[model samples]
Target: DSMGDEHVWELLLPLPTTASTSMALSLLTFRLLLTSSSSSSSSEGYWSTDEFLPENRRRLRDRREKLERTLTESGIPYLPSDSGLFVWMDLREFLPPPPSPDESSSASSSAETESRESMERRERSLYLSLLNEHGLLFTPGLSMKNELPGFFRCVYSAASDGEFELGLERIGRCADAMRRSKEET
Candidate 1:
């Protein structure tokens, strides 16, 4: 009888074992939801270096410069990132276009057609090759404005003109290599 309406029953009857169990379960579920919500809300999603001590920041910056130099020597395009832990590479040109509705239907028919995993593999391979061949490495797939998983980020303390120049040189070399490869085939 008390179970018919929750609010009315609560007012009319003293708490029962079933009611207590239901209440406990609901509270537990609510608490879990709240905890997850708060955790996600607090995290801004991007890695920040402001929490580091000044000396540590300096070391990170120095290391970033050395890495940048190596990458430049090998020929990879990278821009000095202002967010302080990455160099941004524009990959808009390299990415394939969005499939049209007709194309999407055709793609769905072929299980081996382009896939997100395959795209990631290609990008990773290219990045690894650059690292191996030129000692230049980049954090691949990060956005300029937001942080996403598997995105490239650099850890550096300060930006310098010399670093910028070196980065450009490396990018030029990488671009040249890509062009040559395309021409050959």
Candidate 2:
């Protein structure tokens, strides 16, 4: 139900219909109960639900907020997240313009294909530049099957606060450098 998938709902509508599905569902239930029993027990120390769940939620929320603030300050357009660990940021400003059409060529399909390939390379280059130059790992939109060319997924769920801030700073510097280079060209 949480998946909002009708096909899944239909599949599970007749419970115990198939042995494999029934066994899989039962195993999932067993795992959930086992995890609940363990985490609910205070004797588990660090794994106790009371100790870590709220703290982890707070940390994730804080990290997302921080990323939102950095994106705002940098003038980087981003899709406002309602409930997710990742933010979709638009970096189209950093992508080079599409290839100019050849005056003698009437083959628009080839030009379009070339443009797409070129854009993909540019997008990969941006992803690599951030990773290699600043140690920031952002998922390229192309890999995510995003039709838009200049979008990237920025995850905010893992890094510590200090490390996250450092990454943000590095992003700022990279953006500034890209802007400078673009202006020069």
Candidate 3:
């Protein structure tokens, strides 16, 4: 609050102490250690250059590419991200059309006679159907802050390599099943 826009004195915290400084330093050190060596104990493991460089970027890129391939092969659509622990897929095509953006518009009124309750039901059911039928747990895009509907986020790096592969397999199967069902309807 030193240069505060709100109440300067009211928002200010007490001046930092030596103890606080030491604690902050310790936390910083701990974070650096964790990020650099999450759980890889290969030979010559004394702060290798690969631990903090192009190697890590390359690996993340490879994983993303593999995930995109699996999604594509299963007839799922995705908007690929450059570098992240999670992948975002566009599941809109598999889902029924969303309620119109402008509720007051005549076009929206013509689109469906569904009430607000039905709209809520459809949104909730769509979220539940993917979870219950596919045995997958994803944070529905609409459920996340500022993340629009018609998307889902999957974190491939959260599990072991084998488990990640199995999860990908299940996702592919789910996508294929959804596509076939959509086509049949």
Scored by lDDT, the top model is: 2
Query: What C-alpha lDDT do the candidate models reach, one value each?
Result: 0.46, 0.66, 0.59
lDDT tens digits, residues 116-160, model 2? 566787788877877887687887898778887889988775455
- Weakest 10 consecutive residues of candidate 3 by summed lDDT: 8-17
Clashes of each: 8, 0, 0
lDDT (tens digit, per residue) of candidate 3 on 146-185: 2345677766544545766887888888887887898898
Candidate 1: tens digits of C-alpha lDDT, residues 8-105: 22222221112222446544644563355335532543211232234344645665676566556645446664334445554433333344445553
Model 2 scores worst on lDDT over the 10 consecutive residues at 11-20
- Compute the lDDT of residue 36 as modeled in candidate 2: 57
lDDT of 3 at 179: 77
Per-model TM-score on C-alpha atoms: 0.37, 0.69, 0.60
lDDT score of residue 125 within candidate 3: 70
In order of TM-score, best first, we have 2, 3, 1
Pairs clashing in candidate 3? none
| RMSD for each of the candidates | 19.8, 11.5, 13.9
How big is the RMSD of model 1?
A: 19.8
TM-score of candidate 1 against the unseen true structure: 0.37
